[model samples]
Target: MILFPNAKINLGLDILRRRPDGYHDIETVMIPVPWCDVLEIVPAKGSETTLTVSGRRVDCPPEKNLVMKAYRALAETVELPPVDIFLRKIIPDGAGLGGGSADAAFTLRGLNELFALGLSDSRLAEIAAGLGADCPFFIYNRPMLCTGIGTEFTPAEVSLSGLTIVIVKPPTSVPTAEAYRHTTPSIPQTPIAGIISRPISEWRGRLKNDFEPSVFPAYPSVSEIKEKMEGLGAVYTSMSGSGSSVYGLFDNDILADCLTETFAGSAVFSSKL
Candidate 1:
């Protein structure tokens, strides 16, 4: 089975509060982007499972990789054939792009199809929630208003139909743990879903990510990229999630290309909405 696991950007994020389960409550609108990673799985000759990776390096053991973890998790419930998983990573890690979670979700969906598991979307989502909060979102792979540690989701009516998106990831990686530690959870003046319903032009001052205050100070380069995107005539620009990756929504393709050219050393991706 071959699948392309795409990346996502947070339209607006608000950390509501800390929960009793040690997970924080959050409200955000997550939208899929064209940037993706290629994943392939084939039945292994032997009983042992294996994983090999190429493209952008993943600095972790194969066993710890989400693709392998997804296979093991499914194997515990249903009989699964041993498979050799190959991942060609393109999305930048620790950029709040949910690349790893997308990989895991796609793996679950791919395995269900590959083995004829016949698992429904809800069932697959239940299993995906165990992998990560953002994993369930990819099962639907549509714009959604996510809450409750990002597991609970409601389909959103938002669209960026004619817009062009430009994403830039700096060399720095922001640790998720550090991001949470530096942030202070609070209620937003306006709900993210509600804000997204308004005109994109209004998003400039109203829509915001709660993590930016804490994250921007630690990494000025990330903030600079956001500023530059705005200066280049982006309709809206914000840090996607915790930190490191910033995206700009432009009115035209020319502006998108201009912005990409401005950032030579960083990883840049431009595509239509």
Candidate 2:
């Protein structure tokens, strides 16, 4: 089975509070983007499943990789044969792009289809939640208002249709632990969904990621990218999640090339919605 696992960006993130389970109750809208990684799974002729990765460095053993965890996830429930998994990782990790989670979700989906598991998306999601908080979102892979530690979702009536999106990732990566440690939880007076439902032109200063205050002072380059994007006439610009990556929504492609050149030191990607 061959699948392309795409990256996602948080439209607006609010870390409400820390839960008893050591997870945070968050409210945000997550939207899929064209940034993607390639995955291929084939039945193995040998006894054990294997994983091989190329492109961006995953920097983990095969057993520790999310794809293997995905395989084990199904193996625990249904009998699964060993398979050879090949992953081409394009999306950079620690950019808060959900690349690894997307790979895991896609693996679960790929395995289910490859083995005729016949599990519904809901069932798959139930299993996915065990792997990561955002994993379930990729099973649906659409715009959603995520709450309850980001596992629960309600369809978001948000659209970036006819817009260009540019994502820039700097070398600096803010650890998830660090981002959360410095963050103070608060309930927004205005619900993010309500703000997102308004005109895109109204999103600036209004739509915000709760992680920005902590991440910006730590990684100034990431902040610079957001500022530069805004200077380039983006309708809206914000960090995707946590830290390290910033994306801007533009009304046209006229400035896309220029934006790429301007961020030569960073990894830059541009696509149309």
- Which candidate achieves the best lDDT against the true structure? 2
Instruction: Let me know the TM-score candidate 2 reaches against the reference structure.
Output: 0.98
The list of candidate 1 runs beyond 4 A from truth reads 255-257
- Tens-digit lDDT track of model 1 for 75-191: 988999899888999999999999999999999999999989999988888889989889999989999999999999999999999999989999998998899988899998789
Q: Global CA lDDT of candidate 2, please?
A: 0.92
Quantify all predictions' global Cα lDDT against the true fold: 0.92, 0.92
Off by over 4 Å in 2: 254-256
lDDT of 2 by residue, 83-120 (tens): 99999999999999999999999999999998899999
Question: Each candidate's root-mean-square deviation in Å?
Answer: 1.2, 1.0
**Alpha-carbon shift of residue 88 in model 2 (angstroms):** 0.3
> Deviation in angstroms for 46 in model 1?
2.5
